[model samples]
Target: MSQFKPRRPATGAAIAVLAIALTACGGPGGSQDEGAATLTFGVQAPPNSLDPAQLHDGTQRYVWGSLYDTLIYSDNEGELQPAAAESWEYSEDARTLTLRLRDDMTFSDGDPVTSEAVRVTLERTRDTAGPQQNNLGAIESVDTPDEHTVVLNLSEPDPNLLVALAFGSGVIGDPDTIDDESTALNPVGSGPYVLNREETVDGSTYVLERRDDHWNADAYPFETVTVRAIQDRTALFNALLTGELDAGTVDETQAGQVERAGFTLQRVDGISVGQIVIADRAGEVVPALADVRVRQAINLAFDRQGIIDAIFLGLGQPTTQIFNTLSPAFVEELNGEYEYAPDRARELLAEAGYPDGFTLTMPANLFVQQVQPTITQALADIGITVEWEPVPAQQSGQTTNWGMYFNLGAVAPPSRTVALYFEESGSQNPFGTTDPELDGLLEDLAAETDPEAANGIYREINAFAVENAWSAPIFLQSTNWATRDGVEYVGTANALFDIRVFALSR
Candidate 1:
């Protein structure tokens, strides 16, 4: 998952609430599981391919944990806790870090998690030249001094490294586990859960059983887990209602219905926003969406509240900025005042010379379809008629052409979230235009060791995004689903799709 921005006053509070909520879930002394438990996991959409190193997704992140453990972890409370390494010390200069390893841990194949293995795994991640690479950007070098120890030499300090490790790409695996085929296709991991079996027929699905000798047996919550690729929400809801699915992905509109049907709605929290990005493709002057008035007009025209009521089913709240509703960064003061403004929208439209109206094309994949109708109505109100079509997902690991395209992205991290989606070459910045100042902001924040300093930059860029109207926000959606009654599951912040925390009570 990517990060979010802190533009609105309410963002600070949301991040605080999320941080507090995170603490109640996991920690050094974990809560005791009542007893033996088995869980069934459900995935809305099956992975295009199960390669963890490819593109990190929520489902993929959870699945990676099922098979592997990371050297470090960003626990539910957003703190770096030990996974492979028990404790670590950073140099006073903040350039180097030394880690103490766990001696008892072993791979499923009975191989010990040797210090050499830790060094090698990290080496692979840093090998930009390697097939499975990424997430080790901070560290300039890695080495192992002793059997129970590893050292990382960083070019700069990175407090977010632990959180970064929490990503699917950061999970540590046995060096020998890498098969000639895709590591994600079927990779061996050192996690508390192990793959029990794979019954591939229609679409691929895998079953995971808890390891009896799990390294963190004291913290292991569930005995078994399963993931289902159910993309259709209505079908998923029906399955939940009929006891077929443990739970399913839900729109905010359906939240009340689920509660009424005797189900608990575990708030699906993520930094994703339903922003309609007006990309400024680098070539043309008005490139993709260079007209600031045009961007503002689109924002003004979209009846965000209407979408909340119609598509999200009244449970969704309208947001003016791109920060997640759950972040402490989104405090009360920053909560935006830019409610839906129609006349202003029309005026902005005229300013952009699309006075009468403009035809806008909206993309709809299974995910986008959830809000399609509401978006259509919102655009119509501002003289912008929308043409809805399901844009086929890109075949390569690439995004669709940057333009006035309809799409949804999860800006998961609030601190420097947009940078990954904007600045870097060949990164997710779909608009294609590059700004040196914006890239500089990203660089400062990425390398800033101090949270307060990094936050200042975050505020700066978020304000810039809003003022420049670089992006138009729709709704901040969650990336989770649920089972029917009788399933004991916690909607984990750290692990989005972790069925490992689920257990059937009845």
Candidate 2:
């Protein structure tokens, strides 16, 4: 293994100071004991609204997930599972999906969760013009035949409908209160928890009381779940160490220190990877990146393994494909061809008519900052230089399509991941690097229904993407969750904390 020490030791010192400063503030939870009946969780993202339809970000999804139940859910293996809907079946043409809602389900306000409610909730979601409305664009219409039966009519044969529903679009809100703007702050749903409006702080802390009358009450162990917004990594670590939080997500680099501090750490293989999105592939902003050879050279320039070992502290796996290993579209064979080779990278640069190299600017984030040094040195070795343009994490979305942006997000199926970038109207593709060949492949993949044939076609797309070096696939990130001993919890491949399954020590 190649050794590389980071140039910034100040970051390390800041973390140490924050950890020590927490002790001076006194132990966390003055009245809330360590092993109390209530479970307090430290969340990095806070919910902007309680309404599920209005939510778009992962943090909001977690909070909304607690406040509402979805029609369907995905198991650890990514298979569709039932939630509010007891059973579902697809038509032979794959254009229609029928669902059977449970008769026992009821919203916190005592209103029955019926098929009509499903129609209304979904229709309202589309009409609201919120962030999640686009996810439901495939559904042409929703039909409610009876009190417990819902049938969805599709505009086209979309295989990703179930997966999208199993995610944010599937969350069911109470039809009675969904239209009210107050619902954004005080939500009522057929879920395990009800918001304790008196104790809950709008942006800082959210306290939820368990509903014993919920349909799946037996599955939820915590009587009360408290989600606190602690965006700062240092604050999260301090909270975990001082007993302010019973369970909280941690950065992988800090996992060992958290465990050494007497907290139990659980790691899950994430469906997300860290990558650098070269949005300006058309050379609109950076003239040199337009050449495919320059792009390939950029891919070959990074010493992935060395950065993984030194910068990530051996917590990450190097990758060449953007899709997670578990994704059906991910081609294992394609991952090996693009190993780090500086000499070959230099050759590619020379072949692209940039023997002297060229400089480009990229947006910086925490992850970018960590790997920037290695990237700087590796590119310099290949006669290339990069200038990082600083962008705050919260404001990073504005930087997309500007030049290049750091993309560290969860990987879904091909339809949501790979095809999402290549499709003509794809949301993720804003730079407009249009290729007739790539566009045709994406269209074919979308229309194909056979799993075997689809996977084969996807393999071609994956290989082509790697050969072109569309983006620099860094690694499949390992997410860490810290909990006190005796807390029974399991991390998920999807990276969502299913607090309904969490149980305290008896």
Candidate 3:
């Protein structure tokens, strides 16, 4: 079991200092037009990237809510249901799959959603000349048989295709919506929400109205939703407390204040692994964190309870295993490998030739505040010295990308994320680290359409990651947000607010 050490609200003086900024931090919600229905929401930060090709990170994760929609989506159980493609068929050869587009869709600007658009969108996913091209490498080609129909031929059979489509990046935007270097300020897509207005001055915020003509309107609720970029947590909470907002994201630590103030709080198990990446492995130099035991020392030193307390105000639980535990394809044993033990952690560091300990830097942000400090202090108990090197939210420094620092990526399929982050040609692998075996495993797994076989590949990769210490995982962030009375809750694993089905009742 992992112990947690939560970061309490800094002391009396700190709270007093924070209290003054509380209103700026603690925002008050606002109301929409009397009869015009737009659900006003709050976001802690603005999105980072608008280009679908290079979109990765928390802000881009939310951009998914406005600018795109995927071929498939998940219901509460996470089973792939339907989206752009109304229905699909797998060829007898099992390598070719046909997708039937819903003819009832159109871009909010009134451009018809043609089968040609589907072709362009997919081909873009696999085009070397395009962004995210390698992410679609497993796909051999996309052939459109006719309007309303597209046949995707894979290099091999892949059962995870359906799941992959539900991924945020899998969202299909208008070929025109993408410009020469980035996504157009006005992106058009067949998604349920249409971006009517975007204010980019202080921070970018969008005003979205539900599309009554949405391909799936009957299932959607809100007709209009306004998403406000509230960068500070305290401001976000204040807005929620004052009923100035309907629903949005919040930190787990503020759960107590939210409860004390009398508001409804709902949460789902975190599905994303908030991880710490280690680079610069040249075989035998102990690569900063080359040893699994040393990595374990870090993981064990993480006071899960301490984080829950100090950071989360004791609001969430320590995730014992990888988020794979909730994945349908995960095997029980792989989730078992990432367990915690502090004494054993000491033993491992001692075995790794660091009996007296060594100094290391932890690149941090909000996620780091939640765990790294505690992990740093815990490692100190066993004599490990750590300095928190804050990585700015700018382009990664060349040296740091190759040697130090960790950048966050929202949770998606293991194959999808690994393909983007660790593969030889993948953009996130700034360190030039490449394992052909690991790459091949990704290929084999992606090609496996069978849930069982694909799952085996994920397990295999996790085993490899544990042994190699590719990155040290802290814990999945448990997503929780709230709404005042009469506002329905729609919590998603990704924390996106699906405006269509949301309803505000007085």
Best by TM-score: 2
Task: Report the number of clashing residue pairs per model.
Answer: 48, 0, 37
Clashes counted in candidate 1 amount to: 48
The 10-residue segment with the lowest total lDDT in model 3: 1-10
RMSD of each: 7.9, 10.8, 10.9
Q: List per-prediction Cα lDDT, in the order shown.
A: 0.60, 0.72, 0.59
Report the C-alpha lDDT of model 2 over 1-506, residue by residue, as the tens digit: 11112233246677556434432332222233332356788876577677767765454565677778888876656666678887787777777888888899999998989998889888877666655666677788999999999999988766567776777678788887887888899988888889899999987899988787987765555667889987777898889888778888787667878788877777766546777666667888787878888888878877777887777666667898877777777777887877888899889888989988987776776446656777778778898777777764433332333566667766666665653455443444556567878877866766787778988777788887888877778787766778775454564665344564355533
TM-score of each: 0.79, 0.82, 0.78
Question: What ranking emerges by TM-score with the best candidate at the front?
Answer: 2, 1, 3
Which of the two, 1 or 2, has more TM-score? 2
lDDT of 3 by residue, 143-185 (tens): 8777787777888665445555665446676877665453645
Q: How accurate is candidate 3 locally (lDDT)?
A: 0.59
Error of 1 at 161 (Å): 3.3
> Candidate 2 — worst ten consecutive residues by lDDT sum?
1-10
Q: How big is the positional error of residue 400 in model 3, measured in Å on the Cα after superposition? A: 6.9
TM-score attained by model 1: 0.79
List model 1 lDDT by residue over 202-254, tens digit each.
Answer: 23456667787867654554565556666666777776666555556666656
Error of 2 at 454 (Å): 3.2
